[model samples]
Target: MKNIFSPIEQIDNLDAKVIAGIERLATLFKSSLQDTAKRYKLTPLQAQLLIFIAEHSTKLCSVTMLAKEFSVTKATASDSLKTLVNKSYIEKVYNPDDARAFSFVIVDIAKPMVNELTHFGLLMSSSLSSLNENELIQLCHLNLKMLNIFSQSGLITCRMCYSCQYYQQKNGGFYCHLMKKELPAKALRLDCPEHLKSS
Candidate 1:
């Protein structure tokens, strides 16, 4: 087979190389998830839905929320959720606040599999072992910056506090400009309900 990234090397630009690297990394990550999902007789989408519901708070696990989070149509999210429910990987419960909406929760049978999937870092950690702690931190910061850019461009959506327009830093202290309050570093949310796209 031809090398898909070979043309990237011939581009003679750092941006091209960086974009190609990100694309290649995403492909590899998807392949890893596909392999793992196959072992459990689930599609990658189903596995992703299971993991998302397991990680997020109950209030955020509705089908509409899943559709928004995954950038998929509501019908697609509903189909995936139905499959997970059929497999006993997740169950839907009536939402107290919304009569028409239901919230999802991972079933007990799926907890162990979800836990195993959450260790995905272990698969890639060895490859990053050569980097020093400072280098790792720098890489993380760069990745987060890229994520913010992608989110702002509408190429992606991220609910991380760092990606929100309200997130601000002054004098080495974090704050939510929208809420007009300081936030502890440890309290920054990974999936915030009020996340707004940063300009």
Candidate 2:
């Protein structure tokens, strides 16, 4: 029952439904992640920052680095880190190479919270643990193709519209660099199905 359609034709036929489903799935993921983050008393950005920091456990991070990574102003990054520090979740250490910059460290008091985040991620991973080797590999490949198409579509979201730090500093508040309009201070999202993270 093999059809004589060209590769691109086959792709075009599958593209619309698959892309729409993937985008919807991403929306679901965001909602679920938001719920999980709330359980830990973390804002979406805070949770994302924590995850990024934990992933780069081998390297010391800086406010400037985070600002660049998240497409936020250095002042915004400093304030977010300050909030975490005040909560005793993270600590700032003086950098030997640069006196003006400080390195980040996870405070011992936050291990439980951090560990819970890990546990939640693992729980989600385990939801797919039933898939055997081939299925998992195939799924990975499918996701890669989906992401490739999504990236090529040129509809990804901008960070300026997504970070809380960006909005607080602007006079109008909640500025969307892409839209040039005032956005909801809390959401900080592009209201799009497909968005990109600078990091």
Candidate 3:
């Protein structure tokens, strides 16, 4: 029972199987990122950090935040970021409140590579493309529920709608107060720049 990888017939609990499947999916994502990193001559974490900077707001790309996000030490995050700066993939912007602190923005020259890097998730996306609309909706809703739980527990950091002040659940449906609209399960965002933590 403790081993999720025990033969499927030996494990009766659905949760273990589900976790095992998710771990496999995570492995695929890591493999794709690793391959991309090798091609770009960058470390896996550095490549991931570059992609993260390209997609997220610069304010969220600081060394401190990046370290927490990736579960790495500040020194490791800072070293990777320094490598990124040396490679000219990103430029630093000083914090207006504290000149000693800074964040990063992807450089123009790295846009093409960043665009390619963003496709690292395409394999996962494509695998799910075969699901019907309702199935996709159900999957999205369940995944969001789990993600929200993980975020709430401080196991991870996320800017998801489920954790945002604007998000609401009413009569078994979701709404976004900031957007002034009901949110269809498929429309829910895994990460939103406009996210404001719920008080």
**Top lDDT hit:** 3
lDDT of 1 by residue, 99-158 (tens): 887899999988999977756658788889999877876687677677868777776667
Q: Order the candidate numbers by lDDT, best to worst.
A: 3, 1, 2
lDDT string for model 2 (84-133, tens) is: 88888887788688787677878777777776666656666888989987
The residue pairs in collision within model 3 are none
Q: Looking at model 3, report the run of 10 residues with the lowest lDDT sum.
A: 1-10
- Candidate 3's C-alpha runs over 4 A off are 8-10
lDDT-best of 1 and 2: 1
Per-residue accuracy of model 3 over 18-66 as CA lDDT, tens digit each: 8888898889888888887888898889988998998888789999999
Alpha carbon lDDT at 43, candidate 1: 81
TM-score of every candidate relative to the true structure: 0.81, 0.57, 0.93
Q: In candidate 1, which residue ranges exceed 4 Å CA deviation? A: 1-11, 172-199
Indicate the residue-level lDDT of 10 in model 2: 50
Query: What order do candidates take by TM-score, descending?
Result: 3, 1, 2
